[model samples]
Target: MQDLRTVLSSDTIIIGDGAIGTMLQSRGLVAGTMPEAWNSERPEDMLAVHRAYLEAGANYLTTNTFGANRIRMREGGLGSDVAGTVERAVALARQVAEGQAWVAGSVGPTGRLMQPLGDLSLAEAEDVYAEQIEALIAAGVDLIVVETHHDVEEAGAAVRMARQLGNLPVFASFAFNPRGRTMMGLKAADAAVAMEALGVSAVGANCGDGPEAVAKALEQMHGATDLPLLARSNAGIPQLGKDAVTLWDIEAAAMAQHAQRFVSLGARIVGGCCGTGPSHVAAIRAALL
Candidate 1:
């Protein structure tokens, strides 16, 4: 498999596969459905989602195992199939990517907070991350991304686990609200520098806020470290109405323009997160050209 750095270096890599929960909901998955469980029950649909992104000009697709950690799986009644679910997620992505796109194993933060601030200790955090990383590596993921992190300490622990397990390139990304800060109040530059010191292959912002905010965060992250950058912002700020969250296409396009600026600011990987589907990725592809 081509390493993520090699694939990204060829051109600005356009990552796809986001809004897993929403997409599944659109397909009749209930409010509390375990999207990851679809790996065992509805593998074809998962593969179809991956193919859509690939066809939309995405150079990379993350597996649908973001919340597949043991802790979350138990809540979803999938605790027994954690490794199998992760392997299936990777296999399905590879099936769709074929020779076109690279598959990145998606590792979201464990729901618990780390020590000195919460009950979980550093050692416990390491063990949880190790389980996820081992499954991704065994499934032959081209790369691993630890994303949607809110706590700096937890993010650092996850990256450290990745390094100890293997040399596969690891990218660390955090979610930031529009206020220019993460849920834990860590600045973008602080997250970037900390992840860089831990030897992450890339670091940047993702999921929360619009592209403009993410672009500004990228600017803050610049010069914090020499590592490559990754940016995956939402299509727009979502609004809740009539029991649904809605985003506008025009807003997403405007965000794409900011994504172009992110590329200019030196982000090697760019894509959309929540509220961003194939259309958002297509816009990014158009912008790249």
Candidate 2:
């Protein structure tokens, strides 16, 4: 098989796997439990999730390390074990993906607001990101996926840290509101411009209002930056569920429709986020193909 860098930079559109956290929850991961912990504790289930996505035709497999940073891991009672945990997570995904799929080391927000907005300094934030980025690169991830970041500073920190540590391809994505704005009030074009400035391979939105909202955001991003764009939308807007929670009721076909819309707009990467599954990814694969 060709290398991930070549494939990602090629004209071919790539399909990323969907909703690892939710998939773990459905497979008996209790709510509020840190999903990254399962990388060491319940790897069988994690591998199962990877297999599900691969069988459903996904070409990129994100590791179960979304929240494996030092600060977050320390809070989860796994502080001193960060490296071990990350390495294990990547190994499991690679074991399942083999050479057929590329492993994306999933890096998430550090859970602390940056300076001027709150407290954490930019230098400290970069340190926090570097620890996880190093572990992911050492563990052999094909790329770094900095995702679910609502703050441009936070995401930029991660992307830059990855660049500082290695030459791997990195993708940075933000969560947008329905109006195509981030929680920090950054518009789609604004966020894309920021990410492009950080030198990431692709930039776009994820886990927002759903496909339509994400499509709208990416359309704006397409006009703002020349880099490849990624569209990883959620299933739909959330509806009330048990325990005062919310759930997505969007079906496979519905999400697939927007995947097509994203591709039509020249998005290079497309997939689902919250409340998505193998079936949704399969539909996306079918739609794009």
Candidate 3:
């Protein structure tokens, strides 16, 4: 497989997969469930998720290993199986893609703040990421993405680990609120500069507010760095119904418009996040192309 950096430089646009954790939750997965465990226990379901994104026109499908690091796995009583889960997650993604799309090993934060704000030291964070990276690399993923990160320190740690482990390209993405600030209070520009400074191939925002808010953040990030940008925002502002949360079809069209603006602002990769599905991805693909 080609390196993601090389591929992106040659391609006009890249289509990233939509939200996985929340999408699974919508399909009867309870909160606090260890999603990675499904990679081994229910491989078909994991494969189906990846296939849906591919069929929807995603050029890259992220592995189901976002929370597969030992620390997070421990919280779900699957600490000892983190390595196995990570391996299976990558393998399943690759199987589903079957040369049709790139498999990006997804590594997320440990759900704990880094030093000075929480008990986790930088060194400890690095070790946790290294464990996940090793499994992804051994499984031969085409690239790695550190996403939904709130803390700059944790994002940097994952980037460093990716660089050390393999020659694969790394993309670091942060999550933000409607105010255009991360949970850690880092601005969009700051996140861009921080990730680029760590030598990541690309940096952008994901899993944050709806299209409008993320588009604003992408504009700020575009001014902050020269690296390729990625934006995967939610379908729209989520609506809480009596029994469930839902987003209307109009939101998907609105997101497509936002995706076009993101491209104009220099985003090379675009897709949907929470409250988004194949329909949202299809809209983005149509608008971007």
Candidate 4:
């Protein structure tokens, strides 16, 4: 119930909620369909996911608006009402949180790359994130989490926009590959320092290969900056299961052990990514306790 900044400054190890896309998939959501659309069409499912995490003892519940930017919404047939859609997603999380947890507005990368590598310009990138972040703030989210970004500049764009929009805190999290680098080949230490320079509330790695790779990245990041760090790794590399169901390599107990390791490595906040659920969060809560 304390402000996120105050909680972070204290000795409490904050536990953030786990994956939304993967959890929705398990609840009969078809792959490749816009999950954010469920914000209206299937509010019960969204509420269930939020409730599960809150009951599992998550200090933060990240809203289900990761790909809610204008470009992705229009491309995915969800139209261009970015503000309305984002407000709806935040409402879903708030209904479940009920003042017991902080709702973090989730902003992910646009599927395109910036100039020299791709056509999207920096100004355009800022504009794209500006729209989504503005909606999140208007909807009264506690903070903005620009997560799962591979491009540092793109993440910085989100952070810059969020800072300009309001006083709400912003956390920038990047996704890393097994070699401890982003898809764009940025090392963890460099990404941490870059995001720190942008004045993010926290810099972290998420949805990477798994806990081992994430822990390694956090280790490098801890050495580079004095800012608070977060770690939200995937359960593990996903695998195909019977009936075409997706599965991950690491189990809940394994994830719990890594949760402890993340804190030991200087992550002030910890949680799961793809292939995690309430059980994983519950296990993390137990371990952290």
Candidate 5:
């Protein structure tokens, strides 16, 4: 409901809500299940998550639509009704937002790879992104965030589609490896430059190994572009659990160290990725001020 671009461009630091999937898990979401299903199947539970983040002082809440596109939703058995899926997700967040905070439509990478590498072509990928983002715009999202995107072309297509299909601003952030390069070999600065060229309102990093790594990635993004930067790191370094799946252990105070560092480095937006919650966001928000 608010203008994210104006708020973020000002002296204020925008704090985003932390991990949606992890929070859903704590509320009875089973492992390997699609989190977006809660939008329709468990709207109340989804609203609870949004309210928690807002109560904890998040200025921006992302809708649970990261995987609400046609191909990914169908793969996770969340149905191929992309429009209905995103509309419901935005509605759920808007219900809790109540005009007090802004809602960002969460768009992640499609699980598929683009052609010359994978089967999908840039044009084909554009169609998928257009469908997903169009739904978010029509549903009245305050902004569109294309996050954790690895492929330069894929991210470009998403940013471009958002610009063409919606009047809302778009921010693109990449998920970088420990070495500060994306899975597709684009560096953080390169990613920022690439996205800025496509008219993204902001560019930065997210879903990295942890805060330390994310700080490094954001530092890399500096000096390449003057656009506002965002950083949504994992709570801590992911550790292998007994199930052999990666888990996070970054505490609220644990994020404080890197949170300050990110602000000092010019990050306009700061929050957590996997293994984060309201506590983590509260810490980051407090540290930012």
Candidate 6:
């Protein structure tokens, strides 16, 4: 597969894989279990998820390491082998990629808040990000993705670590509330501009209310920077189902409709987030066509 940088340089619209957690849930992942643990315990299932997305037309295969950082893993009682888990996750993604797609090392925010609001300091946050990023780089990922972050500072730390570690492309994306701002009240345009200053390859929104909310965020971000934008919205608002299961309101066709608008708004990457599945990814691929 072409390097993500080369792919981005072309006019091709990239399709990122849909929700890993959602797919795992469908495959019998227990609630509150750190999904990253499955990297070692249930490798076959992880590969299956990657294969489904690739078959559905995802150009970027995101690893199942979103919460694989040291602090989060330790807090979740998943042990101290951050690099081990990350390497396994990347290996699973690569096994499925087979050079047909780029393996993106997924680095999500530390669950803790930074100083003045929470105990974790910026310096400490960078250290946490450093460990996971080091593992990602060592494991041969094509790029790093700092995603689903609410705080720009926290996401910046991950971006900074990835940049400090290597020359791979780093894409930073935030989660927005319905009001078009981060949960921290940071505006979409402001977040995009800030990430741009951090030298991210692309900046945009992910895992918000639904496609319309993500579309609004991309519309705001489109005017803020020259960087490529990514839009990975949830299938829709979450609703409670029987047996404590969570369901999304939007259907595949509906999410695909907004995906078309995302491309028109300058989004170079588009896909689904929470509650989305392979069907949703296939719909997005079709919509882009």
C-alpha lDDT of all candidate models, in order: 0.80, 0.88, 0.85, 0.92, 0.88, 0.91
Candidate with the larger TM-score of 1 and 5: 5
Best prediction by TM-score: 4
TM-score, structure 1 vs. true: 0.92
Inter-residue clash pairs, candidate 1: none
Inter-residue clash pairs, candidate 4:
none
Clashing pairs in 6: none
Candidate 6, residue 27: Cα displacement in angstroms equals 0.8
- Pairs of colliding residues, candidate 3: none
Model 4, span 1-289: residue lDDT tens: 7888887778788899999999999898899898998999999999999999999999999998999999899889999999999999999999998999999999999999988799999999999999999999999899999999998888889899999998988898988887779989989999999988887889999997888889889989999998889999999999898989898988899999999999999998899999999999999999997
Taking all chains together, each candidate's TM-score versus the true structure is 0.92, 0.96, 0.94, 0.98, 0.96, 0.98
- Expressed as tens digits, the lDDT of each residue in 195-253 for candidate 2 is 88889999888997788778888889989998888999988887878985557888999
Residue-by-residue lDDT tens digits, candidate 3, 42-96:
7887778888899999999999998999888988877667678888888888888
The alpha-carbon root-mean-square deviation between model 4 and the true structure, to one decimal in Å, is 0.8
Query: Model 1, range 1-289, lDDT digits (tens) per residue?
Result: 4566676557645555556666666676676778888887888888778888888888788899888888778867777567888999999989998878878888898787777778888888888888988998999888788998999888888899888988888999999876658988989889998998898888988887767768777888886777778888877776666657454444547756877888887787888787777777887878876
Q: What is the alpha-carbon lDDT for the whole of candidate 1?
A: 0.80
lDDT measured at residue 143 in model 4 versus the true structure, 0 to 100? 94
RMSD (Cα, Å) for all candidates, in order, is 2.0, 1.5, 1.7, 0.8, 1.5, 0.9
Candidate 1: where is the Cα deviation over 4 Å? 7-15, 243-252
Collision pairs in model 5:
none
By lDDT, the best candidate is: 4
lDDT of 5 by residue, 132-153 (tens): 9999999989999999899999
Position 156, candidate 6: lDDT: 89
